[model samples]
Target: MSDSPSLRERVRTEPRPHAVALLVALGVGIGLATVHWVGLVAAGALASLAAPTVRRGVAYALGAGVVALAVFAASLGPAAAAVPGMRPVAYVAVGAGLGLPLLGSLARAAVP
Candidate 1:
């Protein structure tokens, strides 16, 4: 065996279902942001690409939730910071509204 892992070897070691769930969640985020229903459609399609079970769904949802929060926070915070005398409510709201709810839902669902 090679001391260094090959690409195929690395791939074989990955958790396949976890990867698929992330793709689904990311698709959902992109779809909603772009108003491209096709993205959501694709997300749903890829979701099934994972092992069809509650665990996979929840994992994918959690990954997507985290990505969405990060994206939203990055986008909103800079804009809010640029404004003079802005109370930062927009940034806070984006973090709270989008990030918290999705994460909470996924966390709750993840509990067996």
Candidate 2:
């Protein structure tokens, strides 16, 4: 039989989670800054690609989501004061901010 490593072995041999997480966060941050909500999903897929394990991939994506939301809120500054007036749109915004990354992270499971 061939001597190629299994998926788990490759995953286990990948870089440490901290490094992977940091890289994922940076990508997520850039994505958020340039592409808006679409960036979260991109970050999720990116996290999945960078992480050494599926669990860590999801966690990184979630962390990126939190960071994305925090940065978005912070960037809003005084404009954020009007958020309460946004009503249902705020719910969609919050949901998308958190949900898209998780959705994107699913790529890890789908991929080899």
Candidate 3:
């Protein structure tokens, strides 16, 4: 009795929009999202839109986090190797890197 199409129906029709959304998300995330941690949230929300379902979107964003970590390490240069010695703080930083995006990716469920 629900007015909306089932999840299956929506997923089947998903790809075209995903392609466009992914591009815009990347543009905004890379070129415009310079607000540090805030940018991570925005990037996750945009990446979520590029998936067929909320779960998939979250997964995509999580994968993006791995890329983000690599970029961060690259930016750190030789100092990156010293990260492991930070112990407790490094744990928090890594967790945030993964978690913030997952938190933002939850926005997918709120959208169409």
Q: How high is the CA lDDT of each candidate model?
A: 0.47, 0.73, 0.71
TM-score-sorted candidate list, best first: 3, 2, 1
Residue-level lDDT tens digits of model 2 in 25-70: 5565546646666777887777665666789779877877777778
Q: Write the per-residue lDDT of candidate 1 for residues 1-112, one digit (tens) a residue.
A: 7598654334324577446455655666555644543333334333433433546554454454445556655766757465445558656644443444344333333432
Q: Supply candidate 3's per-residue lDDT for 8.
A: 42
Q: Lowest-scoring 10 consecutive residues by lDDT in candidate 2?
A: 6-15
Please say which candidate is ahead in TM-score: 2 or 3.
3
Backbone atom clashes (below 3 Å) for every candidate:
0, 0, 0
Highest TM-score model number: 3
Top candidate on lDDT is 2
Candidate order, lDDT descending: 2, 3, 1
Model 1 clashes, total count: 0
Report the CA-based lDDT of candidate 2 relative to the real structure: 0.73
- Shift in Å, residue 39, candidate 2: 1.5
